[model samples]
Target chain A: MTRSLTTVESRLRKQKPDSGQIPFGRTFTDHMFVMDYEESKGWHEPRIVPYEPLTLDPAAMIFHYGQTVFEGLKAYRTDDGRVLLFRPEKNFERLNLSSERLSIPPIDEEEVMDYLKKLIDLERDWVPEFEGTSLYIRPFIIATEPSLAVAPSKMYKFMIILSPVGPYFSGGIRPVTINVEEEFTRAVKGGTGMAKTAGNYSSGYQAQEKASKEGNADVLWLDGVEKRYIEEVGSMNIFFKIDGEIVTPALSGSILRGITRTSILELLKEWGWTVNERRISIEELYQYYEEGKLEEAFGAGTAAVISPVGEFNWLGKKMVVNNHEIGPVAQKLYDTVTGIQRGRKEDDYGWTVEI
Target chain B: MTRSLTTVESRLRKQKPDSGQIPFGRTFTDHMFVMDYEESKGWHEPRIVPYEPLTLDPAAMIFHYGQTVFEGLKAYRTDDGRVLLFRPEKNFERLNLSSERLSIPPIDEEEVMDYLKKLIDLERDWVPEFEGTSLYIRPFIIATEPSLAVAPSKMYKFMIILSPVGPYFSGGIRPVTINVEEEFTRAVKGGTGMAKTAGNYSSGYQAQEKASKEGNADVLWLDGVEKRYIEEVGSMNIFFKIDGEIVTPALSGSILRGITRTSILELLKEWGWTVNERRISIEELYQYYEEGKLEEAFGAGTAAVISPVGEFNWLGKKMVVNNHEIGPVAQKLYDTVTGIQRGRKEDDYGWTVEI
Candidate 1:
């Protein structure tokens, strides 16, 4: 940890003071941690440098071929004046999982954790004091090899950059309307669906925009082949409550296994709630709603810890939740998680990492 | 065009050679064409700029959310000493179509073509003067807004970069092995399957790697839900020849409508070959292959004008195409397209765009 701090300090530079006024992702911290990988060297040249533009060949595979994967988490400043990361190890694990699918080299967990801690420590001032705002940390790996051939990149770069962000949902933990997209699938099984890769967001943008134009908040993607099973809502994993039992779409190889999603399941079980991960077809959910057994629905992700769904418009049919408000179950889950994240609740799950 | 040329010249910079080893996308030409879009300004500030690294905030939606789309085309220096684009308009049209599906702002054709001409004219020296090599042009758009919110970006960047590329199929126009991916689907119907977005590529990489490791050149992705019908072959559109008729998967809202694919169909029809755009399931293909009616299969795209497939391993069964060598029909198609591109044949379709 001492060596890591020293390395981070050496790479640190003066950050612009006016960054506070900038919007999320508009500005970066002074220093960034980088590691380069080559087939011969494996992973080498771990260094911290000033955050600047990446000098990549115009034909870099990431730009043209889209061989890139990234992860999003944050460093929060607790009331005790300590910087903490809520389950960052989960993010690290997910990043590697994405890396393996993208054919990028894996990083050592110990070294990566050390580097992340060091970076967060150096950029501690960037963490906002707002209740919902914090310093957003992005760790991404890209194929830096300059080859037009359609093969995995031989050279790669792993980079970490920090940005101060406000709340993920501008309107707070309010419910969101999702347009259940029967037109497009986010990812298919046997594909990189379960991986947190950049391509998923790009592919879902159209549906998202369509949903927004049609007076919805996000696009709810279904299985590509059948177009009936609810897979995900854009970037978040979805959970449905039917008859007091919480059901989430199983990690069916076609949906992202969100970290917050898994945590919520664990928390639900701890709170004595029946939580099951299984195939959740749209027909069953619609039927559950018809039978008045559907209690609530919500989405889970790193950014939006727990976003309750107000209603879902599927194929011209509007299926509203019982009251079009945040369900009590969802509110409790949000409070419990946010409490743990902000250090108000007991950290029994060992999810928080004090920086 | 005059105003665009004048504006473009202001941004042009002299090319700095990076050693003489032309690696794909590693080096760029002197100038890059760029334009911006906003709700107020629409598409404005069209200019050609020095090839440089984009200064993106770490949280730029493209970096985290993958709100990006791209098109690939090429500029060929024909034997007749003319710089011509192989069906540039088709790429332009397809790009906008992809943009519409991806919720990206669509650039006006006149504006884009004007900028493309300016860049090509400035980078004429970089265009390769070889039989099988040309300057590959990559046009892409990314969401550039600084907000962390998950909505359509208010601002966008449209960029065109050039790279000198050699033959796409290094081993010549020979058939390659493709593994039938039973578990993963590249894009799903009612999803962004037809749109050329980054998510689709990243999602397909894992299956592609698995296919290669399993002794196949590429993965033949099936439809998402059923995983039975054949879809596109990653970057290229899949095609089949059976009983002297050409057949391809119809654009059923899930398959990318490749320009080269449509071009080939037109060419086949011009040559009096029966061409059909309809759903042909994998089982039907195998049954046809077993009956000796399936003569050839190929993939069409800008990179590889046409790539012949020699064999397919579908559901534990290995099936071979007629005559492991390039089939007669594929050879003729390839000869026709490349011949037209290299100036060996006349551009009867008016597909070539002269710079």
Candidate 2:
């Protein structure tokens, strides 16, 4: 399933640096990997060309209709100066799953992985050597067909773009305050909640702004039906440490199937921790917190990794978790996962992909 | 609230005409209107510039994380040589609501309408007089800030583009066969199902594809929880006629607050038709259809106004509403709505906005 990459030297020569000022996502590598798909031609013309603007019709389905799906992972620079990707195969698999849900054509994971390798090879220098910074690789597919019918785009563009970014949390990791949202819901059962599509995030923005304006860091959504169950945080899958056990909302039809969340579950099981993936209502969590049985609360995802929740505001009432400090379980999980991610320990689970 | 005209030219010239042919979303007008928003400056730098490639960072939020929102409407040319819009103000309000949900800056609707008017005036000649053909306007906002923080973008772009479009159903409106989607949900309660964003539609692609592949014309989504209550049909809001009464899914928090849906309700009520915006479960509809009480079912949207539903497959069972004919109720609704839109009838509701 490997794809043969054709090089574009002219595109590579157009590289310009941003004063090398190491901002989050301001700078980009010279090269990118692109593949196009159509009803007649499955997926053809895999190329490594200069990173440039995509000339799309103003009415392209992606702009107006939002028929798009994206995957996020990182290309890290190790101590030995070799580039590496962590569980990119999982990302590709998840991308296909998202594409299937979005009606976008799926791609071969092996070929995508090979495409990533070639892209990384061309942009190796952009992989930052900083302790927390890495070259962020984004694989996304967007409907390119110029039609307004709104069924599904017959044509699509699959692209891989790289950006060097700093750590998500600027200051030291502190517990964030989250506001429970009653007015808005992110995704529901029989909805696109479980897929990594753009519309979910866009729709959550108004609520997010309300949360931030109300002095909270993120918005926590209740289930759309009863507005009772705790679904997820803004961009991450949430978990609650209760009665010496890790409990997260099950992969109900309405939650994104997060790779990091899945990895955390597997790693916790291997480390002899009881993990429960089931419906965890906000009422139950609040009751447990009042009874001093809720040990820790945090969110798991690729960008933030593991963000501890220090306080949560539910319907105008706020509660601090575990004395407003990072709980022991959260700290331990973060250390174990990040240690493996940074190649600071043994790759017991074979998660890292070496370049 | 009305802004003055700011004009720019088209940088790219026309590629010689291929034939006497027109396509959906392929061609674009010469100039585009853009305004940027920042926290300190609010929203400024409103310009009408040549429609050129946007030099956005590769890590732009819209490309990677999908922080975007959009609206769709059209400028119609009447036989009397006048341009009019069917309630552009409603579209503006919905756009702001969408922006608020997406955490993007909300612009003054009147100012936006003014810009749209100026845009149409400049591209007036592009408006085709082909019966039922009009210039489609797409107003979209995207998070342009180049950061990977996964938070809302600090900067945003509000732009308007125009495209000439023909009839949505191509030939005259033919009744369509709809497949009930049991596995995937388009929108769930408390989710962004209400907002007109990209993620929601993208997520429905798979279901729509499955329906089309299975010989169904469109996919109908049910409630996320029970998968029985009707929500919407693909891109349009649906209506059911039973026992001389009109029934539609209420604003159940998960259903899209469509403009066309609202107009149809008003129009139906004005015409002495009993309109009920309550939860109409699929089981109830099926029971009515079995007893020959279901008179008609159609989807209402700006694109087609109202498309009659011929047959629907529900839970492995099939039901024909009007024997594949355009039901009487559906025909009246469509004729009245489209008649008012195309400036062929009275504007009693004041829904039409003249350009």
Candidate of highest DockQ? 2
Model 1 chain B, TM?
Answer: 0.94
The residue ranges of model 1 lying beyond 4 angstroms of the native Cα positions read A1-27, A168-172, B7-28, B170-172
Write candidate 1's Cα lDDT for A203-225 as tens digits.
66667767888999888888765
Report lDDT (CA) for all predictions: 0.79, 0.81
Worst 10 residues of 1 chain A by lDDT: A1-10
Error of 1 at A68 (Å): 1.8
TM-score of each: 0.90, 0.89
Candidate 2's residue-wise lDDT over B1-355, tens digit each? 6545557677576552233246666677777788888888877778788765566655667766677778888888788988888989999899888777677778988887888888888788777777667788888888878765667888988888877777777766879999988988777765667778777776777787778888998888898767889999887999999999999999876788888899989888888988899988888889999899998999998777899999999878999989999998888888888888889999898988887
